[model samples]
Target: MVDVYWRIGMHGDQSTLRRRAETRGDWAPLAPGHLAPGWGDGHGDGRPYLEHMADVARAAEISGFVGGLMPSFPFTDDPFAAAASLVEETRTFRFMVAFQPGFVHPWGAARLSAALQQLSGGRLVYNVITGGGGPAQRWWGDEVEHDRRYARTAEFLDLLRRSWAPRPQSADGEFYRLADAYLPTDLADQPFPEIYFSGSSPAAIAAAGPFADYYLSWLEPHTALTEKFTAVRAASQALGRTPRFAVRIDIVSRDTEAEAWEVVRDGFSGVDLTALAEGRDGDSVGVARARSFIDGPVRDVRDLEVEPHVWGGFSLLRGGPSFGLVGSHEQVAERLNGLVDAGVDAFILAGVPHLEEAFRVGDFVLPRLTHHSPQGALS
Candidate 1:
């Protein structure tokens, strides 16, 4: 049985509306030598920060989602701070907090993870992000090359695992060096939070193969996903470890297939071709893969039908987790079942206007899926 998770938007923007605004040229274009336009100034359609986070957290918890993934980005609210605040608002729901290794020392990461695990009663899961491109990396003053960043992340994870040991730990690496580094209190009694790693580059797979408890990827076709699974499995097998596999995707489910397609059409109506073309100028492998779908046979929004209920129109505008599943409740379930059959052990799903979509999928789609019980909340 594959576990399902939802994304909590930490950027403080109504995703659909924000995209719509961009399409209508409501925001300014990039200035000379600028990489991207400024976003999330709280000017577009979005709930107040506190209200939005609280509403989404409660909705995800009550909807039987296993957890909610809080993304980390230079343009958005700090995920660590957001998760800490959300902990006091919800009960029994886990948080997958995304973080980049280079932004914080290994000791600091370990301590924060331990503290969150204790505070949440073992409900913290760390999503290690090595970042995507040079532009975003430069924002954090990280000048390391792509492959070296993965190497640093591997060392970071190694030290973090050791820091959670019953006793003090020490490590000396090319990127980081620590002596007698340990948490203030022993975290051995409490289980360490699971580590979820995501990357599509070779260095990324090599780094995560021996460490990550789960390997996550943005949504790709089944054949592409199968190849990725094979590569990761081989890497893990070489290290005598078998890590779980997961994917992040968007969903648009309604009572009928036509209704679901209608939602997609409306969302696609806001597409900004100019912005989409500019966003593809990045060097991120994930971004390139996503843009590939848009540049391929998917000429128009209606041509985004990739596989069965899978839709690629989201890829035309969004960078990460661009693929969306659009269909009736049963059809969505069927699409998910196919991915699960293709070796996906978990799913991180989201939709526009997150709160409403959370309940819609929770009420209509989850109950129809096999290997899932909607009777109780996630433990």
Candidate 2:
């Protein structure tokens, strides 16, 4: 069975792709006064930040998505706090909380996740991120190099699993020292959160080999994506483990192909692709691979079409996951099934206005899937 997750916009969202100057949920008022963009007219929806996020989670829960991915960043609300807040609003809707291992100690993370699992009845997953070494690391005051950061993550995950055991666990590793560490019986009994690890580097895969339940990647070309997954699976299997593969991709699905293209007909005409690529500030191999997709200039929007229906203009518009599907529902679904055939068992999908797109994809695209069932949380 394949699982599909919607991305929660913790960093705020705009109403349209065309008009993005004003974001609704960044640092300031999350919902801004009372009116959300589509909430309409003279009256206001009157939702605060957490309330708006609950609505987003509820939308995904009802729209056949298995869960919502709450991404963490310096500028955004804590994914753990955001995910914990929604347990009352949603049932059976898993929360994929993204976090770097260094931020919270493995034992503390275990306690938090176990409490969440107990509350939400095992509706939790993890998107373990090792920081992309750059200024972001500097801001975090982490002087660890690229390879060592991943090594720390591997140690962190190993300890995390051990911390879940009822018996006392001890480890004296390079980055951390634990003496007789163990969770309470009830907390330890709560199912350990399944991990979906992200990294485009060899060290990342090596870390994922022993502990990850899913090896995750941002969407790339089908061929490259297949090759990457092949390597990941081989490494995991060699470690005597079996990890699944997942990809994150944004979408622009519409009733017809023409309507989808019309959403960004002149997207690249005025924008400088080189300047956009150069302006990116992360040191991630995945980022580099995604940026490399747009090698030449841009006279038309079609110039960024790296593959059939896969558009690269998303990097010009957003921060993460540069390539995404931009076609009619049928075309997008076809491409999705193609990716599945190439060995993807899961997906983290997103759109411009998250709440609205949750319903749109559920209504038009999900039914076309080869392995889909309407997976709403029980009311």
Candidate 3:
């Protein structure tokens, strides 16, 4: 059974993929003399973004989506705070919070996670992101080097797991030291949140082996994914552990192929071809690999299609993952099923104006998927 999850975008989002008149975060009239909605002027800052997030979560839950991946980015709201705000959002919709382990100490993180897991009844999943070395890390005043970050993360997880022990646990590591450390009985008894680890470097794969419940990566070429997943599996096996695989991808689905293509075609015009495709220095092999799929983009957006149903035009309109599934509902579902067959057990999917798209995908794309149910649910 494959897990189908929607992306709960914490930052501002555009209504559509088009960038010419992009009204990120909120909505407004883009054209001269265009009539505005009656409710438009009434909302000064529009509604609180959390209200919008709840609407999306509710839609995703009712639509049969397993949950939503709450991403952590510099410009986004805190995933922990955002998830807490939606405690009453949906009954079973999980919050897969994407966060850099460096930002919080393992013990503190465990306590916060335990509180939410208790409140949400085990509806918490951790998307553990080691900071990609660049200005972003500097923005947070982080001084750790690229490879050492993963080492610290490995240590962090080691201590984090130890923190949940029924008896006090102690640890002395390069990055952390704990003496007779343990959670309170109530918090310690809370279910552990599954860790979905992401990274593409050698250090990353090594660090993920022992802790990752799901070895996660953004969507890459299928062959590339096969090789990477194989390495992660080997790493896990060496330690007598097994971990499932997941991919995060964007989606563009419509009733017909032409309709879907039309969206990208319109979005292609808004792309700044020069900046969107250029490769820059980064410590993350994953970020570099994601950008690598679009080999020598010249004119059209479809040129970035590394494979069928896979289009690398996402950065043209918004930030985040560049490659995504772009086709009719059947076509997108077919491609998703293909990934499942290739060993992917979960997918973190996103689209613009997350509120409406959650319903669109839940109604159209999700039903067509073959592995949408979990293994326990199967006869």
Q: Estimate the Cα RMSD of every predicted model relative to the unseen true structure.
A: 6.4, 4.8, 4.1
Model 3 alpha-carbon drift over 4 Å, by segment? 20-46, 278-281, 371-379
User: Against the hidden true structure, what lDDT does model 1 obtain?
Assistant: 0.75
Global fold similarity of model 2 (TM-score): 0.92
C-alpha TM-score for every candidate: 0.87, 0.92, 0.92
Task: List, residue by residue over 146-259, the lDDT tens digit for candidate 1.
Answer: 889899999988887887765778788899888888876555566788888999888999999978888998887666777888999999999999989988988888889898
What C-alpha lDDT do the candidate models reach, one value each?
0.75, 0.81, 0.82
TM-score of 3: 0.92
Error of 1 at 40 (Å): 21
The local lDDT score (0 to 100) that residue 242 gets in candidate 3 is 84
Q: What tens digits encode model 2's per-residue C-alpha lDDT throughout 1-379?
A: 7799999988777566654443555343433342343243544355556766888889989999999899987778888999988897897789999999987788888889999999999999999999877888888878888889899999999888888877988889898777788888998999989899999988888888998888999988777887888889899889888888998989999999999888766444445556555635766777788777676776678887888888877866665667899999988888887777667889999987788899999888888887542322010
Question: Candidate 2 — what's its lDDT?
Answer: 0.81
Total clashes in model 2, counting residue pairs 3 or more apart in sequence or in different chains: 0
Local error of candidate 2 at 277, Å? 1.7
